[model samples]
Target: MKQTNYYLFDWMDFDESLSKDESLWKAYTSTEVKAVDGDIHITVPYQKQVLQEDMLADTDVPQRDYILILRAYGDSIVRMFTSMVDDEMKDTGSYMLELDKALTHKPLSVEFADNVYTIKDNDGRTRARIDITPYNTEWWSDLQPGPQPTIHLTVYPDGNLAKGVELSDDHFSPPRYDALPIGFCLTEGKPDRATVSFKCEADECFVGTGERFRKMDLSGQTFYLKNQDGQGVNNRRAYKNIPFYMSSRMYGVFYHTSDYCRLSLADHSSRSVQFRNDRATIDTFIIGGETPERILFHYRQLTGFPPMLPIWSFGIWMSRMTYFSADEVDEICDRLRAEHYPCDVIHLDTGWFRTDWLCEWKFNPERFPNPERFLKRLSDNGYKVSLWQLPYVANGAEQIEETKANKYISTPTGGWENAAGTSGASNFSTLDYAGTIDFTSEKATEWYKGLLKNLLDMGVKCIKTDFGENIHMDATYESMTPEQLNNIYSLLYQKAAYEVTKDVTGDGIVWARAAWAGCQRYPLHWGGDSESSWAGLAGSLKGGLHFGLSGFAFWSHDVPGFHSEPDFMNSVIDPKVYMRWTQFGVFSSHMRYHGSHKREPWYYPTIAEDIKKWWRLRYRLLPYIIEESRIATESGWPMIQALLMHHPEDKTVWHIDDEYYFGRKFLVCPVMNGNDRRDIYLPEGEWVNFFTGEHFEGGKWYRNVEVPLDEMPVFCRPGTEIKVYDEKVDSTDDIDWQKVKTLFIE
Candidate 1:
């Protein structure tokens, strides 16, 4: 085993008692916070810890590094990076998500008072400012008094924004922040962890920590910022963990660190929104937008926008958890042709690679004997192929041994413990046997892409890049720790896969599961591992809505949830739930029918026609869907637009998490309950029901609307023109949009 000579992270996740652990201050952060040349530069004395034995095994370090630097771009957006520096900023290469520096600038005006720095606009009003109560290590008392210091950056949403209104500061922040403070605070003993608290204002709702399932109002929920394959619908932890939150306060609090963080907005801290994580340098961003859309727009501008997906990708995809053989896939394709159920792509799950799924990337000779010919057959049948993949390489796989020979696989460091310059518990990464790709290594990235290129050459149209939640420990490319690469692992992996796929096909589409802030650059990530229940179905909706706010341009979900465990071998899905899921799935950004239980229309013979009609309708909406997809690429608006994203002024839709707009117009209400009639909100203006053609005025709730198992509520806005193709085709291979009916209704 390789050895590491760096401090390991030693801390527990979400341990609430840390906030009260007031030990005599052994570590102190002395600093000078100031603005220079249109940017804020904060310098701190670096602390070097004395180790007992090996740096890897040392539980706690006496000192850690700290550097705080802040820069504002285009006014309201402020970038703050808190880094522990042994030397200076390390040169990390040209990564896509790197901050774009501003050439032209407007210097920020500041008023300094003791330890407080207030940033103001040229109009002489507070835009955003920080208050830092420095810790005093020299203070001596009866038992040596410990200094408890708090650091907070509070911004006014309407305070003289660069491109927005110059509303007064009194418009946003109420007097409640004093009682429920939201800011950053350092705890004693745990030098590597910091607790961040935000005041829970009246009607304060938090969203977007990357694809969570709880209610839209995350005010009383504890969300763990660690990605896991959580199959259960109610699991608090998610598959994609981005340390960011968009608030009703019109300001966003984002903690940009790679450590596993505990974001608690639950009753545990009912008064404040907070998160606790192992201390490294925190590079947090406080984004101020006038509206939710503006917040999301600037957020994507900071991270990165997703590339445009090909038009055909907008059509429906047919997928199942496991398709053992090529013959089975062909049969499904043949059946779809016989039944006239339109599908653009067919996804063969993990088992297609190998039964053990070691990710060898070799065709299972027994199942897919002649892989190239089989792929050609799929193309000949007018179907695009999508294969499943994960970053982890199982230990006994031949590729693992081969990569080990080439030193391509990352050294197993057992989480942050064995990582450089940090101490952490062995809690986050438990998949020890599965080795990960060392993407930072140029040789390794090319070699891995070569293997994927072989598949692309075999007619695989898309790649399902899955399971990148874990970034291997120990040293990484550029001598950085896994703590530094943890959150970014998925981003880099997707980039490599995307680059390779784009090289083969004109454009690439990856159905990714795990993501970070900038991973949206790779479009089409699915809600990870959901069960087949009404809860899971509804949970998937929340995931898409939240993820859309997180800046992903496009998102997909398993039509009828993922697994039905206890009966893994014999999976079964409820017919009504499946029907409702199909109705909602067809209306989503990218409709993909995926689950462990068989998703074939033949399986549900009773509602087979309904399922076919919905699938055909998905094909019918291809023109509109493709246009919306192009708009997503151009404007960074997700195809599945959250109700609140388009209508933030309508407060009723802010809390309504279940229903959302399909594109720029059509309202889609997913059926979650047993009743044939459910409540649907038609926002401001006349709306026409797709089924009844009855007109209704918006700005009011229409309860008990007819939404059977076969159909959910889909409403079109008045005076908007929609082009519907006269004929529904099974594929996008040959389509004539000229032969479409244009409906302009009022």
Candidate 2:
């Protein structure tokens, strides 16, 4: 085929058959290979490589740090040489080669600084840098004939340091299905603006990262990173920020650097993917394992792990946008107890303050008559209160002026222009965390923590921390740039909030929105501003499932849509929809019945009975849900699991998004369409229906199963156990563990 030699320190020349070792190099055949200005050009998939300028003439050549990149159609390995002599061009000094590929494969030679190295990738276990040589060599070996193709490079050879060679080969290794060669792929157009493309395997599906959206599969969708105000789950502006996602069938991939990057999947003519940013080289790592559980383990090893949540926050939470008066809240709690409907944490939304000024941290005296008495009454009734607050400070508020004077606010010049809406209408402002008391600054974090500590000491058990999606790219921090701080702002804010609450109460809980990669350390995030419709219910489930796959263990949503105000029995807002949504909500990590309209069970006359039934069901399943949360805190596994996570080899489970395995034991198939029957695919196991006690064999798809409006199709995997609690319980405090019923599926 082709032959090439590399001279290292005028001592060694390496030659191999390119056809025999397919793992090392890859070659593509086409009639379009041409030379332009001494550069090789190929236009099939679109790639070009050439040596433009030589820097060896300068005295800095020996001390300069150089990076050599090789792009091939399949897998390829790279080797580096140090020092070259004119006569000993075949061999001389030490050479170091780094093997970069997804599969476990070793290069021919590896030389460490201290000694010559050898590596072996046997049985998928990589053992690298086995020292083979004690000192460096400086002599070249005679070139031998080989069946494979090769390329050669000689720096300062014949006084020309930049010249290199490329050879043709008749034999080269074919590309692997899962392991793509570490090289550049074509974007099929002019390279003015860079684009990324990738191939989507016929049976494969991708999941994880980005904000929660309406569509279950993002196979053909185009996504952008710039933040906007598109509110609903289906629409664009994603509040939560996460740049890492895991593919269910293959390895979990993460782009480590915080740069503007784009991913295209099966969109081009060849269905190839191209990931590009302004940076020269892409910094990425692949976590490989056959199962989703092992993949998550490696993922958490790279990122930080999630922390444990307190036991009390596991029960039912009640929230509404307009829970104005303290007496009204007490009356509702009394009614819940009287009607045997379980309730734990009661959330007071925006109206809790007098002037609707956020972050004021004051109760409306008229509506809340006596703050201490109201809190004491709720505490006496075994319910905690969660107050809603955001990071924003109103312009005219006292805190705003104080913060500005203290340099806690972002400087005017460093702020990004608010182009989304009118200045007065848009709730947008930058908090400079660098020189100022912004979340990015240590001083600002302490300042916000002090505020939260004060609230926690005032008998508030939970804080519903909202907002944080739209952080300006120009905002400053001490050591980080604005773009770097954008996704991280929410996590830092939540950390400050958590620290403050924990300092005061010894235990803290926050219901926050907008998160990033490692934000799973903070518990309880909610889906924002869903409309009050049947479609919104489906959207909530889809969003929650998507979040669960992305490493978020705890998630919640408004039960009946936070923005709808229609009659409960209308076609779009039927009682069946409310009941079904409630069933799904209760199974989540932290259950909350919240909406713009009154979301209490008794508010809807048509669905009142159904709500009561589902409320009791939630109470009964509290033990299982709480135990699952504890497991998630310890293991980094999500409370809600995709089937593929539990079974990676079963290809059928990879794309089944509509149905998800709640926790580990229960498989929940939510009815997305307005029908009493839904189809679900079971993965290689015997399953017992939780509601009907019907047995179904797995490893196949089941269709048109009858499930009533008041019932959710929940099944337990074979050889699993679930614990059920008391149906009439108001709190989890004094529940008898011995009295719990354990269901064992075989």
Candidate 3:
């Protein structure tokens, strides 16, 4: 492996033909090399390197592209290939690349055609590219050299370096290679179109690289690459981020990318996996699968997968900008329940904590007396609690002191420093999870975990894991650099809290606001702060649908608007908005009523009756939603699916972002506007209106339908079964499925 201070590059020794100079392929200065993994690290010094014109091939062939192949260690090797088309080697063409187990005796192929070159795997899958046109390099000798060889590639005006390979003679290859960093293994095999299989010991499972909807454990089951995020365990984020993962089954896959991704298992451990990216190579890996899938699955999964949320979590969640006193909170919940309005979870905004220290995690005794009893009372009434919290630690927080004393927090320079300032906006004072807690250091993770444990013991059921997405890249960590930690900060923080919650309560939930590629492993993710207009609601749904498409499963948003006027700006709570949003929320894997303003039905009495009706509708639909959640937990399918997921082949569905498919059955067309009528499109399948039992033809658009204030457009695909429950129930566990009615769409 080529080892640099920051990255580990896989290395390999290939035939002389693959190198610029046959005899000096392994020479240090001629081809500077570093061992990151088994991957060969090669850097070319600019002035010292020479390219023999004769040795350069005129690869441009019309109607065909070329693939450039380099072989490293059969497994865990990282390979990169660039192409030059035509006699004028100035313009480098598109190239394909792959890294994985090496093949025996098979030649890697590169195709050149129409002034474009294509790179493919042993099986011929295109990976990455450098597009070059003949016009741009009419005269090859016209190019000037500075310190490196000028290989012509596409250049973007936005300062993006594209379409070319930078050549330098400063090659520094390390003499001896070492194994990959922690939790990795090396294997040997060839790259071929044929499926490759490896033996995994019994109980070994796979995790990482793909967007999954369940907890970070995949043992005794198989998974494929498909992006989806819904309101369930597997559905947490709006989109999938990382295309790579390490398998606890001993090996892992890192699909090289910049495009759509896919992963399929041939069988448990005795299987072949494939990675596909738009302009990148098909990179695959194989390793010894010996440990239980649970351990490796979670290990890699935790690296990507977030934790599951708490169950009391499934209740009605009410939120608004501020709820100052415990009495106000009590009054809101009491009014909702007293008025027979369904409600469960109560959210307290930034005001619940000490005003002097904005996110101290300490309840203000003045406003909230007898915190324990107050929470117990809410719990007794079937209400669960969620408190808003960020990664930032308050300036005077006792926890900050403890964190510093234990060396569990990040230091600005060399000592304890406040990460969250009292200014209320973002502060550099926030604890950098990537830097603060030395997760690699056993002591740090333990110290941080203890703080969360105390909260779990305090009856805190859910934590809003917020603001991790905006981590500053300038911060430093004693263990990990800021850049490396920036991407995984959310994962690390969520994992730490999740671990503690699980230890104390067996299972816990975190409603994280910001995330990176693998943040989906966490149970619930909400859209970032939004406004209270129709556009905001529409944006919320679009964000949710987009996130689902990206690979997040369970997503929630503040009801109405998190920062909108309580009266909805004199527009009144448009029943169309409430009704449509409710329908969408009910079909979601998890539903909650939240916003910056009070979202309780009684708050908007004009729509209270209709809101109650929809609340009942949601309660009745719990069985179906729950079952969908279970299915999502088992399979990677999201509970809230985009229409394209159901009709992938339908070009129309691909651009239909305004609507989404709720699970496999319901098609929800939310009213993004305040208009009473909506235009809805039905894909090429018979659809039945849920409320009216009206059937609509597939593959067409319908307009001018007078939607009642109490209804949103909901269509159920023909031949699907829907389960319903009583609206009065407090918890899903007590609902009798047998007593619930099942409706057939047809």
Model number with the top lDDT: 1
Q: Per-residue lDDT for 356-445 in model 2, tens only? A: 534477788898888888898889888988998776555645576666555454544434243121132123233222222367567666
TM per model? 0.82, 0.73, 0.63
* CA deviation > 4 Å runs, candidate 1: 1-34, 42-68, 84-106, 111-126, 129-153, 156-158, 161-190, 196-200, 266-271, 354-356, 413-434, 471-480, 737-741
Q: How many backbone clashes does every candidate have?
A: 16, 30, 97
lDDT digits (tens) for residues 1-746 of candidate 1: 12222111211232223345322111123356666765656554333222221111112535333555555656556655554323233213425344435412345567788867777655565656565655444544544223222335555533644422111111012211211121122345445554434456657678888887777767767676876655555567677777788877677766766667777653353455655665534555677777777777667766766788876787778888778898899999999988888877898887786554556777899989999999898788778988887776665567766776675767655433442322121122232344577887788889889989999988888888877776556544444467757777788888889989999987777889878877888777888777787888888888888888787778888888777746754667888878888888888888788877788878999999888888777777777787777777756478888887777767777788888888887888888876667888888888888766778898899887776576678888767777677587878875787776766756
For each candidate, what is the lDDT? Answer: 0.67, 0.56, 0.49
| lDDT of model number 1 | 0.67
lDDT, model 3, position 148 = 19
Per-residue error for 701 in candidate 2, Å, reads 3.2
Sorting all predicted structures by lDDT, with the top scorer first, yields 1, 2, 3
RMSD to true structure for each model, in Å: 7.8, 13.3, 14.7
What is the Cα-based lDDT of residue 595 in candidate 3? 56
- lDDT per residue as tens, model 3, 1-746: 23232111211112223332221111112222233322222232212111221112112311112222233222122234322121111111211121112222222334556744443334433322223343333445534422212222211111112211121112122222111100111112211111112223344334444333333233333333333222222233423345554443233443333233333332322322223222223333222122222222322322233333444465567776568878988888787777766666777766787673266667888999878888888778777777776665544565666666665655554333444323322432343232334453467778667666666678767777766643433445556655445445666677676667667777657776655555666668776554556666666666666455434557777665444444432334554566566655766666766654456676666777877777667777766776666565543456667665566445565456667777777888877666767788899968888778888899988977667666788888778789766547654434665787777777
